[model samples]
Target: MPIAEVFLGAFLQVLFDRLASHELLKLAQHKGIDALLKNWEKKLTSIDQVLIDAEDRQLTGDRGVKLWLEDLRNLVYDMEDLLDELVTESAKNKSEAEPSKVPFLLPSCCFNLSSRAFMFDRKMRSKMEEMDNRLKDIITRKDIMRLTEYNGQRSAYRPQNLPFPTTHLTEELFIGRENKKMEILELLTGEEDDGTYMDIKKIPIVGMPGLGKTALAQQVFNDDRVANYFDVKAWACVSDDFDVFSITRSILETTNPQLARECKTLNSLQDELTKNLSGKKFLVVLDDLWDKNYENWIFLLKPFRSGVKGSKIIVTTRDREVASMVDAQLITLEVLTLDYCMELFAFHALGVRNFNHHPNLEVLGRKIVEKCKGLPLAVKALAGLLRTTNNPREWEDILNSKIWDIPEDRINVLPALKLSYLHLPSHLKRCFAYCAIFPKDYEIQRDELICWWIAEGLVEAKEAKNQWNAGLNYFNDLVQLILTWGSLRVITVIYL
Candidate 1:
């Protein structure tokens, strides 16, 4: 999701509240632009109805929707500034004069003035109408855009390929998880209790997105112990919309590129793959499997069945269903503890496992890791963001920033993380977005958070008596959905 999209829904909620306020509308009427304000409110409501859909499609890399969102964003910002100016002017007028029952939002001195001021009013109306026209254009183009996600965009921004999917090891680059690596090694190298084996077994490493499922797989796969155990090993990234032929070709390319090149169809590729793995103890790591189509999964397994008994395939995925569909014993990767995450953070950010000498940053660094909620990809990306800057305040700024507010190019772990956010109910999106205003280290009380949610209009107050309980229920739903790494690390995050 675009950073600007983060606040759109919530900001619109507040904007509507202000626009409907009698005092603000009186000011607009005083300026003789009340109709323009009303029109804008209506048009923005229309856009808000489809804002979630537009954001969903924007992730699909739709050029028109992207442009439309950019236009909406710029227009929203300008409109907000204009509203702020009006409010400030109205406040000044109120403070200068006595409060009367007249209900005038701004005094006559603001609008009832000389010809030069009347000319200024006319120009302001023209500008307001022009902005409304732009909003109208956005609506027109939105209809044309049919803003929705495409099939391919599921994997468009996801990191699917292994950095070094070969015999060469990147274990040093992977921090911590030695115990996990050992457990997987035992599974990979150990035999059945009956001292027998099937043709091959699937070792599914399942976890939520941004948890470093691939990195863990890489750590285990590239270990010297496993490298010396299997006769054949290949790593293929099977992201969304997994195609049998494409995956087969990728698997074969690591084994025999020339023969893989010769294969042009699913049949040819699988047959070649079968030959490549036949009668051999093979280890194939299918990294980032997103497809849950059991038929396709079973079909893709045809060649693997030809491998020698005790051969194994390690599968890394964010979905448990995909892991279950593989009919394998799955290993759930737990969230790294704060200690492990700090080390991982420092490693990626400073190319070492500890902060050692950066005393000014060590505390901020831990808070940054806590804000990351111990998700490795987010931790690494955010740490990488600080790798170039030593300023402690810069670290603080990033910590203080909302997940979406950070520039995409600087650190982008949110694409995968946003999937969890998208699954949220419409009301919860605003609830979650508004929570970004809280300080990262603030220890929140349930009652306080509930009050804020109700005040922000993110959730219906229902009857005032039940509003607190309603907010409490919504907060609980968020807790169940949130990626909480440690029991004590409870915090509302835009990163999901």
Candidate 2:
């Protein structure tokens, strides 16, 4: 029972409650429907506290409580379905009876219609009573469980007195990226390959979000060997939106600031790029690319072909598909090792490479570092959170807390990770959110997951020959986006 499930239950309750107030429902109120509606509303009104408490308990790994919460969630879903069915039936009846404009003009037919309405009312009343009994039973079980609301005070993980810095770290502060730096440098400065038609060689640095891809690129970009090898250099942050002209303009400005100030048209921009890069070995770094359109990549790289044979373009992206589309030699980044992770975490948290001054906190710090799973960004983020705190209890609390449970606005690292989730389309969002039901590090079967998505009505109903194919396409899109990692042959896995 994730917090997401609780929020979803609350949302469904609100929707069904609104549906309970329709005109047809009002017309049937006197047939014992009004009392059932009142009882349902009364039971649902106080569920917010119950959901919050369940969420808190789930976060703390209260298995027994989560089982109970799951039961409540299923009941809520059943109630929502029943309410929706009632509304649909009521609408259908209203629509089907609309042609009879003058009931008094046909007395015998009116009497027959009244009799049918009475029968319909009796059936609905019986259904309502059955639903009411089911709800009452659930309520009694809830009371016996004594699931109380969360009464503990909430506090920010980061210290209130010390404001966290929002800027990127200097090279001196970056740790455990030396091997990656050397590899990228070798690729950038290596000898040009022979018999290649493309003048500009492309090298892509690919990894998950916040794995320090940009930092590694920046280190290589500013290195003396790289700077000396290329005559011209430019860097651009090509985030989700990949506008060709904007990127071209940015390249021009970085290469020659004076030319960019005067160039106004695409033709002029291309001319300037040619003039500056022609016959010169150059390096261009494109950071955070999300676009995978091969045509767009070709268009963006068109002007760079005029540069010398050794000229190279370095791309940093989370999506392997983007890397593939760019047709670059790939330099994939892996997570840091435990030792390096600890070094990085300690540097930021206690201003040292080791916890020598605070040896007593070392054990707690190690536990927190384990939670980071060797991801540099996670390590850095947790370090930032603990920088202002000297309490062992605070560190322990973070060690035990689930990352998703943390408030997004407070944790800088989470928003970076969440951006990938937020950018997904509505259909993909539902599919991805549904994965929260699985435990961490669980190997998810692609076919089983798709089946579940279809069953949940998350997949859109189209006139496709196979609906599972549509669901598979949705899963592939998520994989292409690097939100989940696996292969078609094996299994799909989500880190969170």
Candidate 3:
């Protein structure tokens, strides 16, 4: 037998031996419950302070902390066992004396002692839980707080909520995408229905930066068909680190707010998710998935598969590879067409009224919109940045500046985009990073050298604009390559 098992068995044997002897009850009766409890409380306080001091000593490894914690736990267990024995003895004595009703000797008691032990155990357990929670909070804060740098400005110091663009304001705001919406609908409905099991289709929406992939998914998420179809809906922003527990907690909070307190373990989380979703359809949207590992995807999806059928997993990412890796039936989102793009820009900038009637400003507005290309993200970003500005000169300057031409190393947004780029394996890296040179949203023919990439020797083919098959392969391959690489940008997708 394992040493741990042997030791545990021995510990229990010794415990039972002492309990049968009623040693705990005798000690409490001899020493007085109040005095004994006062001593135990002192010991507990001392142990807690010692643990805190040891933590401050900056122990090299967790071994010391683990050992100390284990000792404390063992102490608690022993105390609980002793209390149980005392309670049993007290009950036995009371039963034995019950027949002598005329004497009814005062059942003078270890009741206070037993109560104190129970209270002590409760406090100890609470403290342990609080300590564990504090440690997790520290780790999470370390990870998240690194995202922003303190600039010593009051404006920066202000605690601001996510003020990024929303789906409502964007033109592509579920603008006119029916086919993709239907695909999502089919996954949630259709003949694939299992009586209880939900076939989790992790559909990854992959596209380049500024593509309205997230916007499209968000639209579908809020669609009346989707809302009506899934009985339970939970949305979580799974940024880079992808803490399973945190995400689970967020979903639990969203799906059934009261159960958040009950979710303490992964198993509990799974149980809660299953219990809430059983016999009821559900939709879970994991936005901004950055992790590429199948394990990461599987770990989260495993529980959902057991959910009621027609339950769906929709993930939006810039990396098509992530989509493919997760077996997401790829919904490739392309940049808006010229007409759609112009319409979106006019809607945002001119606010539904036609600005084209104004000769001079119309020309200037068109120039500004053209500079943003057909990319809704960039247009929306520029629009929000310029929303308060009515200055014609500022608009012209923004239009004239080569913001798109900003060097890869200099732009904050470029580096954020590059984070996903840098994480790709070498072969994939060479294929993807090569596409960085293409003008934003430039629709080079699929076979057209993937033009920039071919010249860069990232791919083997030369430009063949007329060969549809070759173009398709090249386009699909490049699309696959980029989507696989993933997007690092943090901007929430919003349609204007």
lDDT of each: 0.67, 0.65, 0.51
- The true-versus-predicted C-alpha distance at residue 277 of model 3, in Å, is 2.0
Model 1 residue pairs with clashes? none
lDDT of 1 at 39: 84
* Stretches of model 1 off by over 4 angstroms after superposition: 1-171, 192-198, 404-496
- Model 1: per-residue lDDT, tens digit, 253-274? 9889999999878899988888
Worst lDDT window (10 residues) for model 2?
483-492
Each prediction's RMSD over C-alphas, in Å, is 18.6, 13.0, 25.2
Summing lDDT over every window of 10 consecutive residues in candidate 1, give the lowest-scoring window: 152-161
Clashing pairs in 2: none
For candidate 3, the per-residue lDDT at 185 reads 69
- After superposition, candidate 3 runs with Cα above 4 Å error: 1-179, 192-194, 408-496
- What tens digits encode model 3's per-residue C-alpha lDDT throughout 5-69? 10121123232334334455454554345344445544444443233223222122334444544
Per-model TM-score versus the true fold: 0.52, 0.52, 0.48
Encode model 2's per-residue lDDT on 125-221: one tens digit a residue. Answer: 5666676777777677667767665333222222123222211222446677787788878877777634333556788899986587877877888
Q: Rank the candidates by TM-score, best first.
A: 2, 1, 3
